[model samples]
Target: MAGTIALPLEEFIASLDNASLPKILQVCSGVYFQGSVYEISGSEVCFSTGDLIKVIRIELLSVSCEDVRKNDKFELPINHTGLFKVVPDEMPYSSIEELLSLRPVGLESSLPFTFSSHSKMTFGTLTLGPGRALTVLSIERHKGEEDQVRCHVKGQQEASAEVRIPLSSRGEFYECGSEECFTLQEIMSSPSLRSRRFHFINTTKYEQPLVLSPVYQVHAIMNLRKNVLKFPSNLEVDVVDVTEQCKDADFVNPLSLTEVLSQPDESFPAVVEILECPETRSLFKCSWLPELNKNQHLVFHKKGTTAMVLLSSLKSRKTQQYFLVSQQYGGRLRRRPREFNSVYELYAASTRTPGLKVSVTRNCEEVEEEGLPALSVGDQLEIVSCTRMELLCESSKGNKQSVEALLCQHLSDPNDVDDDDDDDDDGDEEVKEQDEKTEVLLPLYMQGHFVEILSDNKKYRLSDLEKEFSLPLDVKVVSRDTGLELDPLVGAACLRIEASMLEPTIQASFPHRPDYCFEIPTQWLSLSVSFTKHPLPWPQGQPPKCNIERVTEVTDVFFYEFRIRGNTDEAPPPRPPKRDLSSLSVTKKSSKSEKKSSKTSKAKNKQKSVPTDQFSALTLNNKKRPPAPPPPDGLNDEPPPLAPRKLSEAETATRKAQPNTYVKMEQSIKNDLYDMSADVDSDHDYESMDESLVSMVKTAQEHIVFY
Candidate 1:
């Protein structure tokens, strides 16, 4: 990912200052309040300097008594002074003149700062000494103005005080260059008359004068000589320093960069340097001069001139532009670049290399050493060491093949092989390996998980169960699942490729994570927000996810009983059954005898196959059988038996057991109910469906039972 290229100062500014351009970056917040300052760590420039992200200021002027003295009109009865925050978006159409004509809003003491936040803010405390406080008094007619309440000020002081704090602490200025130590003498030169100067001073919105460029010297020297006018001297000319904030300033001259570079004045001479493109064939090294000129005013500076032009032919899918720069020390007798006037262009450009270890983009974006250029499906290219032009490779496919070959050259390292990158690979300890531009503690947000479950119908255990129950019960689960795919954890559900038609019930709750305030552990607490934003013309989930099963009744319950007190633990008292299960069964067995029983209640009834009951209940009073052994081969079965059944008389007649016996038979029938009924809207027979991992409640309203 290492590369280099030059960019003209003017073009460089344009590229970096795109208002909507979002860069992967981090910043130390610079705002403060209370005894502490708020330092920002986000990449968003929500507020900077005096830009007023959203701060309000209001000042009250004049009182009713002052107006009474002038117009003999007494509107307010007493004290008067209003100052408070006004909502930024709510500026009234009328002026303060009209506003004052109406009744006052409220007392100043009750007025609070316009904005507030729970998280400690980091910012500078713009200090204003009490001497700067502005207080105006008038005998007026108003409730609070009358001092009838005298609550805003202590000691019932008659004088009211109003304070307006300035945004900055000092009004300082620096020279355009390092000649800050120049005396009045050096500033007053005669030959060139006056030198253009800069003034960074600020004064209360009022126009102030400090001799921005020493006009006195220019006037004096102009009166003294004629050659001074002919000298054409430009002093410490505020040559837009392409190296600092000045580079981004819009006031610089367009030709200034060209003037600073040395170029040949003779026949177009060309000097070349090799530019390596990860994908395409290297392009020819352009000369800086009139050689590439195809027009009058413009010239293609290919060597070390600033890069403002992008050659489309030289571009790859992964890159938007690449500059061809000319050499720095060029002259008329040296290389001359031909003129180019396409909407996009490539030209010679120069810029100093930044000293930081961070990797920089040669002709496109700045990237890290390990960064890889995003490549299209099939692209091939190679870097020509001799020519410096990135040449595209031609596969059997031809042109598109060439495009594909160039794209392949974008790989981060030509010599390296690929292996799945580890998750914890960041050069920094706090940032995770795969988490790009994201802080580690953000999702767990001080350590916690965000949970959401998908269901066709909204049904789930809101909390994890701690106790197991015999009868099916409606429950809520609060289980702690493993970390989800990182994207959904920190973003909205729409980001999940698995997002689908199923409605998802999402709740943000925290799991166990240490809280820190300074070095001390605070509460294990985290804040969460939730709401659903349905996708428009929503796309279906990926990989064909399973449909959510509908749940109606919960037939049983499960729960756990425990209490926490710091590190101490306590066992909760056992709960009771909703209804007694002793009366429902036709056959019965003693509790004592049941202890020795070996027949599984399920298999026992399967074998006995008693006659169907006339009435049904939640817990059968029927004889309890030995517990069913595990399925012989370790398979799982569900939903215990429903009710007893009786044998038919025909079956009894066929039976030759010890004595003749008669048994009742239940009618048997089969039907394609779903197809025949047309609107059955049913899938599995609820009563006979196999038990699921979770249980459901029965629907008989009269069968009073507890979960």
Candidate 2:
């Protein structure tokens, strides 16, 4: 693979060793030289090739072949060796002779070398490297007149192996050059080298002058097998189908098959984003046809300009009318290299299939009724005028005849029609004939016509006109050209539907009032109530009474006498269905009902316990009551009933007596504890006194005559 070697001028020069003394190197810029580096000075590098001496600045010697391994295998340097194809350059060549006259020029010498041509083709064997060479056969053509006569390398075959070459001017002249064209712009600026081909010739001596043979001409060559430098190269563009994930890309709106045919002239924004490698490149803005099954072609163009055009069409089977259009961006030019403005337009007719006409505009105007030009599918027409008309004539015939016929009909004669079955058959036949005559001869008019209806807008039908006139209408033919309203009947008049109905009156019941309205009916209003604990001695007065405040009333407070029906019961008004309460219950329904009953009983007991109009003070005593004995064993199973809140006078006295007995028992226990403590103190004192008397007697006897 051929590639680019980019490094500092000094480092590339430093990679050279004794064995790699004879090497081809390039300067950074400002000078062109492809010679062996003879000597390296502090600020200069010298190059020579027998009678040729080129001294380059140290800074200018930027690019060099540093690959110096003797045993390393090297493939073709695709970038340097013009062994690739040559495509039509932006510069146009008119004839085959002009294109074939192109010659390869050296960067340093600007020396021109022409290819040896035979049978209108330049055939040469390219020596790729040592023991590796291929024959390059190319031809020039004056095809595609836009950029005429392109140079193309037809093919490459092993030089040692025999391969046949066709001499005829036919088949595809492989497209090249546009993408494979190589230049030495990176290393040098002046005396640029560009060739139509390249061949490598291995020389043992550095001073040997490079020459070409009658079979092969050297465009440019690098001995990669003996260089330490490896250049980066681009792989050939591989055309593959877009991945299944990208088949329906999320970013781009592809043209559907129906849209391609129906909306041929419409231009849709072509935006596609590849989510897989999103950061690598910006959005791909290119036109696409959804109807085309082929995926987008991805080209990796490292250098130069590229342009792509795709044409797609759809045709009608019966009419042979089609929508032919080509979508593409302008090819890259010096002024606009990467153009984003893609152009697409429908063709007047299909060039591929004869007799196929393409329609660009969708609006088809009437030629007969509007007195416009007759237009075929591909005819171009411009809008003259557009206006709104309440009534549009449907039939091509004149409108005056239809209006006159309507006015002649007698609307009052329907009541006198025959009711007999025998006459019905005759009447039907007469009605059918009259209908056919009116349809075939007179112009039919559409009274109501509009794309959209806005507020306060109105449309009227024929039925409305009949209803306005009670008797049969007697219209005198009025000329719109003269701007006259002529009617023969005395009470006859013309009136618009909007004029007759000043304001629309709907017959349905009133809708719910808006939230902003304060006068919303009481039934429409939602009321909520909350209860709070009242303070003690709450507004002491004669009696507590509930009061109702009259906030607002629509009518004067009217006192109406009501006669209640004693036999019938008024049905309750419907209520909104309540939310399910089953989830709220912790226990089963049976247990829940028992709990509710118990709560209700407790509420009743509490109400009865308190005096309705009086306050009862609570008094607590400090005396402790005697602990009650444990309930009998079997009685423990049943819980004791709660005592009444208010106790009778006798029961209260008895309860009070129970506390007195407990106090007495407590006092007796304290007296017995005191008596025991006194007896223990008296015994302890008597023992001590007795011990003291004995000690005193012992001391007196011991002092007298114990000796």
Candidate 3:
């Protein structure tokens, strides 16, 4: 989302630097320990942390730190000297007496500190603990005070040797404990600067000098003539180059968005190609002046100027004033800089209290004049009288004015009257009573299905159900079937329209879509309704109706009853008993047996109804076997197992005795057995002799034997 805005590259970099550096410093400040320098090179400086020496690159200081200075130096006790960072507002002091009397409250380091011209010398008071502080100072001098010094040395022979000390060393400048003095430039340039002996601890606290990389060197170009710095002049060129490289990119100027909005009728929308700032870095919205060459460097007028003005004379107000500053640029009122002001303002001529300017921007025009008072809803006001054109009103403090001049005013209620002048207070009581009776109807979410049966007998189902249910049943069912409807589902109930009601006066919101509202009539399609709650007072002789809305999201599949305000007077419909597998299986098997018995009965009925003459000759065939036909005509019944007659002669005798009727019956029995096994859920063997089909086959075989 941030990529959608066309922010300048420097602005983006500045934002990143502001966000990242503070977080890094916060984290480092908590854990950074005092360390001594171990090594220094062109790229990085390594500092010893007792256990390890961490190397910090010189490039990091310029990239992260905003205030970077160069060639500044400081000193410490025990003859230690090194270069230190300098603050932006550093000043030079020549007298130590002025430094000792200075307070350190507003200083960045919260300590007594001073620096010489160009920050060449820095004096600091380090508070090690209560009552224990170290005062260290540094100085820069070109020439040494002493001229030439002579020293005499004698070599030791047998007994003793004597050495002569210089008399110039005891001069006035070498008195007290401050005897030693060295030129600052000489000390900072010596070999001892790289000896790793001095601990320049406070250098990291101040503004470290910048080491500019090639790409970032453009930022170093600032206005040096005014002892100040501004944004780089070539920034506009870089922006144009980048835009040309990415021609398809969106060109949105966040600063000039308001300008674009103000100029809607222009042929082409205005786009800000460059953003310039002064040395203070106070950015403002600006545009290029006319008739300027491409590379001639155009100057801009101060865009918007804001000021904090105070109004000291307005009545009954204590808050300060804020103004939206506009400037007269090129003889026209142009918009001001897009800076935020925290003052709360009504932006009306009536609200401001006119007074002297508390603090004004360099040149800003006041947009609103001051005279009128802001009127609110509950304020008290007295109406004087109405003229031919406008009405007049007076304030409580006796301020009189025309009502037209006021920005806002409240109208007095018609029922209100002066209590001191009125004899009776009955009107007020009547007004209060009317207010109490005025009821606002809210939406009611309801869902319900028709009640089918009153008794718990499974004999009743949806087929015998009524279209609607009401508290009183005998009332002529005003609803008619109209030959337009059919019975509902097997056991489900239909919507009971006759028992439901809706409010006539109030509009009900749609259950599925709360946004859609409509007024429900007192009676629709001549449906009957009865309310169990208290009777509603009717206005203008209108009948009372139900105030309800149905939640269609609650489908009719589940039996739902609306319960409101902890009232559970009506219970939900009872659920049917669930069928167990054992009972289901038993019933299924019994049904099959009953079907078989019915089939048998049907066959018996057919046999009894058949003409006797059709099968009169078959009666003898059906009779019990006449002693096996007298042993097949005198041959012994078993004829001593007469040589198995030729297979064809035996088949002929059997076919002649029993005709195709018996053959058909046997084939039917076999088919029935196969079908019975196939109809079961699991695998079954029809060949195995067992229940109904097996018994039927055995009976048929016995009948064949008898024949």
- Top-lDDT candidate index: 3
Ranking by lDDT: 3, 2, 1
Indicate the residue-level lDDT of 350 in model 2: 16
Q: Is candidate 1 or candidate 3 better by lDDT?
A: 3
lDDT string for model 3 (1-707, tens) is 13234433333332332223211100011121234221222222221212211111111122111223444433233223533222122333334333322422222232323222222221133111212112232222236542321212222363322222122222111001122233323323333311111212345554343321111211211111111112221121211112223334322221222332233343121112223222211111111112112212211111221211110111133322111111110111111111112111111111222210111112222211112123222322221221211212222233333212212123344445556745557876666556534321100111111111122222211112222221111111123322212211111111221122212222223222323322222111121111112222234345333322212111121112212222446533222222345656888999999999999999877755653432343344665432321111212333222223335876877764443334444555555555555665645432333455346545545454331
Q: Which is better, 2 or 3, measured by TM-score?
A: 3
Clashes of 1: 134
Which regions of candidate 2 deviate over 4 angstroms? 1-193, 196-425, 440-707
Deviating ranges (above 4 Å) for candidate 1? 1-209, 214-266, 270-707
The sequence of per-residue lDDT tens digits that candidate 2 reaches over residues 38-101 is: 2222223332221111111122212222222332223322134322223333354343334334
lDDT per residue (tens digit) for residues 215-259 in model 1 = 111100111111111111111111121222222322211111222
Ranking by TM-score: 3, 2, 1
Which candidate number maximizes TM-score?
3
Cα lDDT listed for each candidate:
0.21, 0.25, 0.26
Tell me the lDDT of candidate 1: 0.21
TM-score of each: 0.11, 0.13, 0.16
